[model samples]
Target: MDVSVIGSGYVGTTVAACFADLGHRVVNIDIDEEVVATLEAGEPPIHEAGLPELVATHAGPDSTGRLRATTDYEALLDTDVTFLCLPTPQHADGSIDLSIMEAGAEQLGATLAETGDWHTVVVKSTVVPGSTADVITPAIEEVSGRTAGTDFGIGMNPEFLREGTAVEDFQIPDKVVLGADDERALADMHTVFDPLVDAADAPVVETDTRTAEMIKYANNGFLAAKVSLINDIGNICKEFDIDAYEVADAIGLDDRIGAKFLRSGLGWGGSCFPKDTNAIIHAATEAGYEPAMLKAAVAVNDRQPERFLGLLDEHVGVADRRVAVLGLAFKPGTDDVRNSRAIPVIEGLQARGAEVVAYDPVAVENMRSHFPDIEYASSAAAALEGAHAALAVTGWDEFAALDAAFDTMATPVVIDGRRIIERREGLTYEGLTW
Candidate 1:
């Protein structure tokens, strides 16, 4: 199968490589010259586990495969299926910003019309419901002068790849969902994804386009709500003297919940959860319906950063203090800081005029780019050195060893955000919810 993947970010690049690894010819199209150049040089521009190895194994120039990447849209005309991996980021009003996706669709439509190609286009990016037919299909039809299911085919196959574990998720996903209008197009997509299905040992969930689109948003919304629920529980537990970890553990035994995103942390972060949850709520509201519980979930998550700051004030007063923030990324093993709670944590601390020295194993470089005013540290130890207090925002493995590495911090205070650490003896330990 010949596939052209649009957008070369983490999602696009990994999808392109995975398809290439599955013995398909892939042409990855992107607008960034630097990113395209980086991919062509056998180097992954973003940090992800096993990604360099995956790219080297499959999409590497020296590798014996027909995987090539370019910035030209003209190359896409030759591919059998073009995967839209572009981002549909959240707008300022919490609605999804589909301008990028719309522009891409318009360009794709115009190009398809010019080339007169009958290809199957699959939207692999996360999008709000009704977007595929309402926006994308219409644009493509306008460009190609061909109606969907009659002339050109289209489908919505959302991605569920976590940033840190994206390549692994791609290889071992729980399911491959195909949202298509026609059976022929959906079956054709199965051919392109057959390798992933075989590797994942997972079933292909075939459904309508709207169901498939909602699956992505609903999955993210549920995960975000789960995290918020635990954190909300943690907040209430903080008022009364209760161990949130024990409560979370006891609740995990239920087969219905199964304990995955039931983590009590400094709330959910990164690109998908916060935005998707809000978008779903907003979408429902626009349609004259309201999701009150999900709305509360968003509110609770929004309060997390401030709650973390308040916790600092509860144990250790913030006046004339130097606090260490360990772990900048929302999660470990990835450098993405989009919608990270640490932003509010840092802002809250700076508002109090307390000095903040932050460090993340992989995110410090990118963190420095976003926050040039704060002090940057080479390591967690360096961030903790001579600091009045420290907060563990990310649950990196290095943070879990803080009990044994107590000598690293000048002050014996630590705040565990991800609930990874229960009791680091001999230190003034505080859990965000604990």
Candidate 2:
């Protein structure tokens, strides 16, 4: 299958590379010249585990000519399938802002107007239900001057790739969803994903576009709620002076409740959870139904950073003192800092007049854009040195190995948010949930 992915952001780039590796000829189309150039140079524009190797093997010079990138919209006309991987950012009210997706569809439709052969356009981006049928399809139809399901096919294939393990997730997915109104679109999607389906032996769900969109939101919403529910339980356990991890471990023994997302600390905060939860909440409210449980989950996640800062306040006054913040990224194995719990933690520390010094293995440069004035240490030990107290925000594996670094702190106070640190002699350690 010859596939063209529009918008070379995180999803676009990863999907393009993975499809190429799956034995499909893929061309990544994006408006950014820098991203296109980077792909052409055989380098990934984003920081994802195993993405560099895939891009190097399939794209750039001296590699298999299965993958390439271009800045032209006309590139889509040559491909049998085009996946709309543009970002659907949120508005101030938490509703999905589909301006980018609509604009991309219009451009794609205009380019497709030149061709008479049927081409399938798959919505790979996460959008609210009814977005494809209501907003995106109309945008493309108005621009192309052609009828959908006739001249061009429309399909919705939501991506379930996690940032840290996107390549692995794509290669070995738990499930593959293919949604389309017409058999032509569905057949085209099946042809495009047949290689991956056969290789991974993954379950395939065939449904309508609306159901497919809701599956993504519902999937994220359930996971977000589950994390918050655990955090809520963890907070209760804290009140009773109970170790949440112990309780969680025992409860996880039950086959009904699995152990995944059970380690509750600062709650869920990444690109997908926050955006998808808020988007679904807003969509539910707009449809004359209020989702109270989802709203409470968001509230609980918001309160975690404050609770962490409050724990710091209990140990010592951070005002007029230096505080070492370990880990800036939302999770380990990825450098994405969007909606990281560390953001509010840093803000709370600053509100108390504390000098912030933060460190992450790969997220320092990304976090610099958020707090350029704050001190960024070269290493975890460097951040802890001469600081009044240390707060562990992310559960990086390196932080678990620190033994003597606590001796360098002026006060030797440690507040662990992710429970990656252990209490030892000559160090006052406080776990957020344990």
Best by TM-score: 2
What is the C-alpha lDDT profile of model 1 across 229-301, one tens digit per residue?
9888988988897988788889999998787877787888898888889888889999999899899898999
**Model 1 Cα shift for residue 118 (angstroms):** 2.1
Q: Which pairs, if any, clash in model 2?
A: none
Off by over 4 Å in 2: none
| Candidate 1 displacement at residue 117 in angstroms | 3.8
Over 4 Å off, model 1: 403-405, 408-410
**lDDT score, candidate 1, position 429:** 79
Task: Give the lDDT of residue 15 in candidate 2.
Answer: 95
Worst 10 residues of 1 by lDDT: 402-411
Please write out the lDDT profile of model 2 over residues 1-434, one tens digit for every residue: 89999988889999999999989999999989999999999999999999999999999899997999999999888799999999998888999899999999999989988989999999999999999999999999999998899998999999998989998999999999999988999999999999999999999999999999999999999999999999999999999999999999999888899988899899888899999999999999999999999999999999999998889999999999999999999999999999999999999999999999999999999999999999999999999999999999999999999989889889999999999998889988888887
RMSD of each: 1.6, 0.7
